[model samples]
Target: MSELHHYLELNDPVAMVWRKGNSQDPFTDRNDLLPVINGIITLLEIPSSQHKVHIDGMVEINQELYNQTSALLPEQFLVNYANGSIQFHPQHEGATFSCKYKGKGLILYPASRIYAMVRRHPDVVKTLQEIIDEAHTKLNDTHLAMDQVEQAIREAHDASAKASMAADWASQAAANATDAAHNASHAVDSTKLLFKPAVSDMKELLRTHLNPQVGWTVQTYKDGIRYRYDGKDWVPIDIFGKNIQLVNEHTDGLMSSSEHSKLKSIPLETKERVIVFCLPSYLFQGVQNIVARFPFKGEIVGIKAICGVPGDTDSEIIIEKSMNMKDWHNIMSRPVQLDAFSHYDDGQAVVDRATVYAGDCFRLHVVKQGLNIQNVTVEMIIKI
Candidate 1:
């Protein structure tokens, strides 16, 4: 009747519509008014004391159950429908506070006063009339719409308009077909974009073979993605993040590895391939751990890595493969940090990301003959 409560001010009491005896409603039980009551309670800021504020000698007229929510009571605030209330840490209320419902020396707060104050406003009275008119109009329109829908459905069942109905459906289908065609055109454009690289490659191949030297030069670079061979190894150098400067690219790669082979008692540069062991059976079951140092002992291929530190350094790492559970204590007890490693398969140095287990064919396995190797531990430095 009163515009159905479009808005409520913070201080406006809710009892005007919710509290038992505080409001006049033909329906809505007092016990079922918790939400409306709590909504108002959520407002109204009242100061609190540190210790709990408890009120007794009260009575609850409503039939709602409070036992279920008592355990979930917040730390600093408390609410009692009537009989009693316990506010823990009363002094530290939240940004918003609660008000007194009924207690000794406490003025009673109800909503009858609120409803009267608001309903008396001239603008509110006008709005209420508008709301009543809108409701009636909407109800009439709803009935008319339902009748129209029913008549339309009945006509659809009639055979007299078969041609008209067919035409309507055909028009809709034509629109859909047009949209699908448009979408297919876009898809073709996307397909062209997807194959642009392949087309360019083929064109270049044709041009190179047909003309033989129109826009081509022959050169070879280092065996790494980062380096483009132009007779010598030139690493990608982007200066000012714009132009690429061709410089020497240093890399560490595995040459070869074997579980049975030793370090060969030689310097790393002397061998093109690295002699390392496979991963531990316990850490990665059924797999081999093989790695090589920088300046590989054999031909470099794919991606490669080397020991990061200068070969002239005085550090001695203990390299171990096929680690047993009992040897874990020995590895952790070491004072030095471990080094990075790489993967080796068969006799070649390659990068294998697809391998998840040690037994993979792509995996070239190696291991120190014993549980550990002194003066040499292996870690990997992968460069894509």
Candidate 2:
């Protein structure tokens, strides 16, 4: 068995001895002679613009007094990284400063007379010290200002981050609102399908369920008329109905189709199966029952229709007919014979026998009048 060497985190050996029966280790040791490294010497700070005192001396600054003043370095003398010698020109009129020359070495200060002026005029040291102290204070203030700038930058960065987070939250809120609106729309559609009125026989269904006591005439609609109903009284439905702001100040579209409010419409045709009818333009709401008319070629065996009010305001649907389109009579009205055909929340449906003479076309009228309510939807299912 043999032992292995183990090293510490600092890679220093805890113990050293002969290995593998060797007489001595393969390393030699000797005393390490190191020079004393003194603390860094700081130089006095002064501007070169006017402080530089050129003293062509014959000697150098005394090692004991060199680089011993603490002050802020000038803008030109400040270094980024690595260390280098920077000249500090202090404010002084005399050439008491000295430096080493190329070949001559020791260059005496004051050229010849003041080779060591500071050494002789020792009182000058006190005055120079005072000047250096003032410079040190200025430099310290500059450092403090730089530190404050860094702190302001950090604070601004934090504020910007918070604003970004707030924006993200606002975006999330908008997305949630959109989802809720979409779900509410879907629920409304489901409710409509659940409560939709369904009927197969038009004539019998109307005679048994509608105002058979009143005159009932089939109001023919143009092709492609859409069917719709309101959940509450037409009062609430008025707000939902697509309306054109009528500036009653001016008379418009008295008899023109273009000026009248447009309505959703469908085609009126003779078909073997049940078909839907539609009309163009707004509903006829007045004593006039002439809102829309349809003229089909063939004969119709069965006819069913659905109609209702669009506002909570009271109104009536009068389906009047005239063989000559001049004198007309009603076949069906809402609220029995006591009132005309109408509905505020519920749909008013009717079925009746309607036959068109081969030579004479049938003329149907939709007369309505009252309030601001003017439009309603009607779906027709006719069997040929």
lDDT of 2 by residue, 59-99 (tens): 11322344464343221122111121223333222223331
lDDT computed for candidate 1: 0.32
Q: Which candidate has the top score in lDDT?
A: 2
CA lDDT scores, all candidates in order: 0.32, 0.35
By TM-score, how accurate is candidate 1? 0.18
Q: After superposition, how far is residue 28 of candidate 2 from its true place, in Å?
A: 99
Q: Model 2, poorest ten-residue lDDT window?
A: 99-108
What shift in Å separates residue 218 of candidate 1 from its native position after superposition?
19
What residue runs in model 2 are displaced by over 4 Å at the alpha carbon?
Answer: 1-309, 333-345, 351-353, 358-370
Off by over 4 Å in 1: 1-45, 51-108, 113-168, 183-187, 192-249, 252-384
Single out the weakest 10-residue window by summed lDDT for candidate 1: 26-35
User: In each prediction, how many residue pairs overlap at the backbone (N, C-alpha, C within less than 3 A)?
Assistant: 44, 41
